[model samples]
Target: MRDVQWIYSHEVVARPQSQQPTARIPAPTSAMQTCGPLLFAACRRRGRPSPADAVCRCLVIHLSARHDGTARRGGSVAATTKPSRLAASPTLPRVPIPTRTRSRMHLHQLKPGEAASLPRHLLEAHVVALVRRCCPGLLALRAAHARLIRLRLPRLTAAFALSKLLASSSSCGAAPSYARNLFDQIPEPTAFCYNSLIRALSSAAGAAPAADTVLVYRRMLRAGSPLPNTFTLAFALKACSIVPALGEGRQLHSQAFRRGLEPSPYVQTGLLNLYAKCEEVALARTVFDGMVGDKNYAAWSAMIGGYSRVGMVNEALGLFREMQAADVNPDEVTMVSVISACAKAGALDLGRWVHAFIDRKGITVDLELSTALIDMYAKCGLIERAKGVFDAMAERDTKAWSAMIVGLAIHGLVEDALKLFSRMLELKVRPNNVTFIGVLSACAHSGLVNEGRRYWSTMQELGIKPSMENYGCMVDLFCRSSLLDEAYSFVTGMAIPPNSVIWRTLLVASKNSNRFDIVQSASKKLLELEPCNPENYVLLSNLYASNSQWDRVSYMRKKMKENNVNVVAGCSSIEINGYLHKFVVSDDSHPEIKEIRLLLREIADRVVRAGHKPWTAAVLHDVGEEEKEVALCEHSERHGSWLPALTGNATTMSTVGVYSTARQIFR
Candidate 1:
């Protein structure tokens, strides 16, 4: 049969035959009219009449003839074709064509039993475009997917189309499981398909989705057809970071190295972030240094944050300086890390400078940055300044409120902390675990045992599970209120095992209350949990010494030697002129150490004259009385306090002011 081109319009117009005027077919019936253009276009594009064409042709003839058995326009049809079984069927449901997509019908001939061999690229492109255009929601996506299945296209074509569908479904709020099922339908899933699913699941909330992302990446690797690319490795590493699947992350790092993707900046950053978050700072730094060129903000931020997490404040600040010298602009994330380091070091002067720098440089002090500033100021003994930052924030989250509340609690403003917590609840802001920690700490500070218990019950009512920190706070509350029996009972009744911190808290309280029996028990538990901790050994040894149990004291010292546990020197930091100066017990390294010691002796004489006696019981060693007094005077906190007084920086005055005021009053 010869091929024919039909131009659809209000009237049916056919291409002219040799020596024949263009034939006009009468209009189709209402039922056929609705589907006429679609059926004719499909048939014409295939270049031959299929069973659908027979139905289309028969419908046209049956509807075009008048009721009197006459052709309305006196038009003669070329052939009278028998209708297929579907010819008399009801009107088919209309498939809405996207307004943006135009029809591209071609008149290509195919042999009998041969399917259309669409250009692979063109077919894939068209199907992908169609899927994206129609899939605005899950329902629309599913409809498009069903239409694709009905077309029975080749496997690769269908896979390409389904890949787009998978991407859309994952993004349009479809569950991760739905995307996984959709991906399984693809016969040979492409790397793009796997990458899309992995990225979506990794970014989704909850552990299960993140785990699914790793599983999908693993399946992609095991399939061995489409190798995991840089994107796949990066996303999988991100999931590992969230899950903290350090073991899996290590395997992916090795895989990246094997695939020569270690050089990729994306892969390097992913590896850096994974290791940084997992607290493998050494590995994170290794990855960071291995990068070929200048590090970006993300790399710098991750490395700095790793240092802050491990309490390596000096390293974090030093790297921040390096980042600045490198001419790299620090983003909010980098500033937050730097601020946190300053908080840990009590570098108040530096923290203030960073805050000013943020304003001077026009960097956005978002909620997170503001919250960090609050924490830094509060920890630096500037609670008022912390409150200023908290109040200045345009919007506050649970973290911001918690930071302020905790700051107040730490500063011994127990009533204020409780008041702010009440305001938070009045505003309907949900309090998280950290908030309760602050609240409980405030209660502990003021010996509000009943209030502490009430808040603990309230936390449970709000579905906020108490973390280890919360449990420790509750134990401290009981101990501080002199509820020794209750504190012990609480520790015994804890749902989770009591850690060394809890045991240490109980031991300190027992020692303070002179309950030697409880002290012995707590000391035993503390030693069992943390035998290498010099503080625990030193604490027990001091108790033994105070009670005149010289043999037990000797035994404690001997056990310390056997365990190779050396006591950690007490250290204190004071910030002056934007510089952090640290001093350790008996430290004489400062250039002005002789002058500081001379001034300290003069102040000690005045304090002693005013009946201020040193508490020599803190010295655990069997030393002379004079030697114990000397050790107390040489403490790091005393040294740190005198330096700020010597510098005349009133902002840093703390213990020094007490000595100065007492001497003046006595004189």
Candidate 2:
């Protein structure tokens, strides 16, 4: 309002030395003239104006000065060599000159709670709007939160801000406890607040058990107000799916149905997934059918996934086909289940078809789906294709690497498997128990005794305890290498009790080596653990006969008959064009038995010509030497190998006829 001297002026005006020659500045601009002293006086009187009002005033002043070509460089005002009209006018009040400190004071120094004259409702509205904009960043949010607490913001406004913080933290992968702490500080959280916390906890994998979601939901229910909505049941059902809590999930379903919320798409999908994950496929199907043609992609996917998880491979494939026929598009989740079903069935053609479909449809090969593809290719005996997919992955997670390593391990590619494991470590990807299992199995299968010991030590160093499967692999490693004493010692010294699988591995190894010293203990332990497994009795019988203990063998046989335990005969299978042909020892059920027998005679003649005599020691029957040799030639496994050769061309003979036998040494 008064003539204020320009701070960046290069010239001084003429004045008396004693008076300091008060510098004459130009009148205030028209825009400032219109506002006059009212805005600044109000702000000065009120301590601080609203941030928005302050910002608006700054923009107006800057734009007005710029339009008049009076803006100067370095944010300084341009000085004019003219007398100020305001200085001569005695009818006006003087306005304070705007400075950096005053501008900042108006913007940031305002205490929100100090605005007492403003209605409480309007203050809370401003805080809510501020929180909505700040929700995307934690730092901005915390700063906002601090300002609110410092100003003692209304409880409702603070609660909403805390709720947003919890939701944002959940999405950003912050610890759920951080949100829990914030939630606890609220005096009384609304249903929205409770739902925010529940949803956050529901999605936090590996942080807490799914049961935590159930507990939070119970707390909400008991709060007696701000009751749950459809979103609440949806998240609760998902948590139940994670825990596979069929009982809790069913209760939620009943509650939702009673409340007329079951028709909600989100709630229905969650319930369907819950029952499916709980392996109640029938219930899941009921949920699906009740929709009466309202099934979405997720509903179909959940049904297919349920069947696949329960090992109903055929049903899964059938449903997948039905899903396609119904014109319902499949997402990555659905294809993952379809690929997994193909893996279980060893349907290589079908797996390839799915892979081609993915490429054709431009579906994203995300980590989970890529892992499933690797597993499918590997299990279908296409390790090369599995490796191709593994190599093509742009980002490999633990699951992808583990699946590839396990695939190689099962295919006897021990070197490749271990190399991949080493590479995974070098890449700083922490190998979990599943990864260790694959590496240990590779070592076991490849007879790498030193490597097995090294890995076992490394596993311990990595703070991974040897699971039952790991222990079994170690036992198998020693057994395969004919170190029976070490194998037995390893089993007995296990930190955890040896499982039936470990005992079976040791028993079979002992029988093969004729190490009867270890047999008695291993057999007793095996029988104790698996009393009804007829294979165990058969193994004991065979072991006794191997040692020429005919009387004991007969006693074992009589006991088996008394127990009505029929042995599971060893069988070998060959896959030809997706059809599997299985053969049991002494089986004559095949229509091509005549040709198979003739091929067997030819193979026996050829083997005799090659100077390889039949080994009859494996014959468990108490018979003469000639009878044993004849039985050996008539073994179904021997016929199984020869049938494919006689039935197919030379190429098929080289590939298809070489079926792996399913015979165990103990049997």
Candidate 3:
């Protein structure tokens, strides 16, 4: 037999088969031999001889000489052959095995059927390199895919590469359909492949794609060859959250429990987000409480955000405090949720404190967080602060611009809102439906009918199909301008069905205009749309009482009783010293109710002395004039207004609406 030299660990040994040690160094396998020339060519192309070049040259020479039968039988090839330069070089650098292996797997040199000769680990590495290089471009990815197919790699190897390609396609702005097609091409795909597709589609832009994410996840469940892992459950749960598939989310929650993946941080957070987003706060809390280990910020943020979404402001604030107690630093997301809750509660002082905390902690205020701050400040009656935050933002997206415009509009800063909108258009910041709502609202507030119409047309021209809120704003615009006929016409002519808010707007405006016919019609539509809304019943009853239709007013009351609809008492909240105090009409629940009542009486007496008269005509009850005045004095907003009097140092107070008597006193 011919003698051969084999690389054994760190050394090259040459010997004939008969004389070889029992513990022989095996000859270079077909993988190394096939890949050797490819590695050598790669080194040459770099125009530099690396340590890999020496290794590859030695491999090629030994393999070639052996196959060509250059060594005669029974002769010592070591004596006949010059020693390999690698063995002779006293200071030869060690070849980086991984580097050489990776270099040989380049897509250009990698051919069909040749990859099969490579070890499984090397083939996987090659597939990873192929994916990374080609994932960014669809055309390049398809080419790499074709090469992968031609090579006919093992199933697991191809699936791994294809799974990566599937995920990258979904995230790199490729259509979900492309990802679906790639997923279909995967033969007996593993849970990893299903997870990759599910994750990509879950975060897709629209509900339809998110639904597809759930579908892919279900397919994984049905296949059942490879059960869903922790990542699979996490991604699938996220899709359920986005689709708001509450039933599916619950099912996944159970699956997590059965699989014992409930303890996984990813799965637990996903469950929390799923329940929280679906408005199932109680269920979400159960899941949250079960997270016994070290909780991350995401878990806390998701829970707090759930409370904020449902307008459970107190709960959200309490959770935020708990998060702080846990020593978890609030990120921008946490702050956004907290600020949103404060806005809902009108907890101005608390909002300010949260803002200060953000600044003190040096948290990065991204666009979403900044927008939330603007909205919170605006709703808290701090328009100037909102404007400051808006101006301070280094970059503004559409939502940021819309938030500022909406804030100004609600605060009745019509000119500023309009000017800001104009600037937004000038800066090429495309206005969405929300932006038009603010524009139309500003016009409605100022009774600028022409400007409202102009902006409405501009919004349509920008291809922004009007949403329900946008249509509501336009209806309000016409109604506030005393164009009751136009408002009615606009509602009837809307492409989409007018919701209760639009009818309610028309009803209020018509009642204020004393157009009983319009009020009757609007109220009928509003009641039909939202039969349980006590405000609609009260408004209609008040309209009847104004016309001395006592029997009709009684009928309305009877209808409310029959429907079990109780009037929602007017409620207002004021924040002082970081505590939120709420007051309803004649509320006696406050711990300092006596002090508030005493201060209120004093303020009322002073306002009466100042020649202020309470407007009791709007009172719906058919009572004596003195009783109407008393009822007006006992209004919820009037009760809220006395908070500053009780707290002496309170600079700002917010109320739903105060009686004329209270308004003058508070101002």
Best by lDDT: 3
- Scanning candidate 2 in windows of ten residues, the lowest lDDT window is 73-82
Per-residue alpha-carbon lDDT of model 2 for 1-667, expressed as tens digits? 1222322111223335585546554544676645533554444454444443343334334334424322221121111111212111122222333343233332344475564554555555555555666666767777766776777655665666577666666565556787788889878887777777877777677635367777887787788777778898888888778767777788788889888989888898998899888888888888887874457899999999998888666678888888888898899999999998777655566678889999998888899999999998887677899999999999999999999999999888999999999999999998888898899999989899999999999999999877898888889899999999999999999898887789888988988898877888988898788777887787788778888889989988788888788887766654455444567777788787778877777777799899998888888889998888778877766665565567664354323332334431111
What digit string (tens of lDDT, one per residue) describes model 1 on residues 39-154? 55555445545543554554554564543212211111111112223232233222232222211211112122222365565566556665766656778778777766655667
lDDT of each: 0.77, 0.73, 0.77
Cα distance off (Å), candidate 1, residue 74: 36
lDDT value, residue 104 of candidate 2: 33
Ranked candidates (lDDT, high to low): 3, 1, 2
User: Which is better, 2 or 3, measured by lDDT?
Assistant: 3
Worst 10 residues of 3 by lDDT: 71-80
* Superposition error at 643 for model 1 (Å): 2.1
Q: Pairs clashing in candidate 1? A: none
Candidate 1 ranges beyond 4 A from true positions: 1-99, 103-154, 165-179, 204-222, 586-589, 606-612, 645-667
- TM-score ranking from best to worst? 3, 1, 2
Evaluation by lDDT, superior candidate among 1 and 2: 1
TM-score of each: 0.75, 0.69, 0.81
For every model shown, the clashing-pair count is 0, 0, 0
Model 3 clashes, total count = 0
TM-score-superior candidate, 2 or 3: 3
User: Which pairs clash inside model 2?
Assistant: none
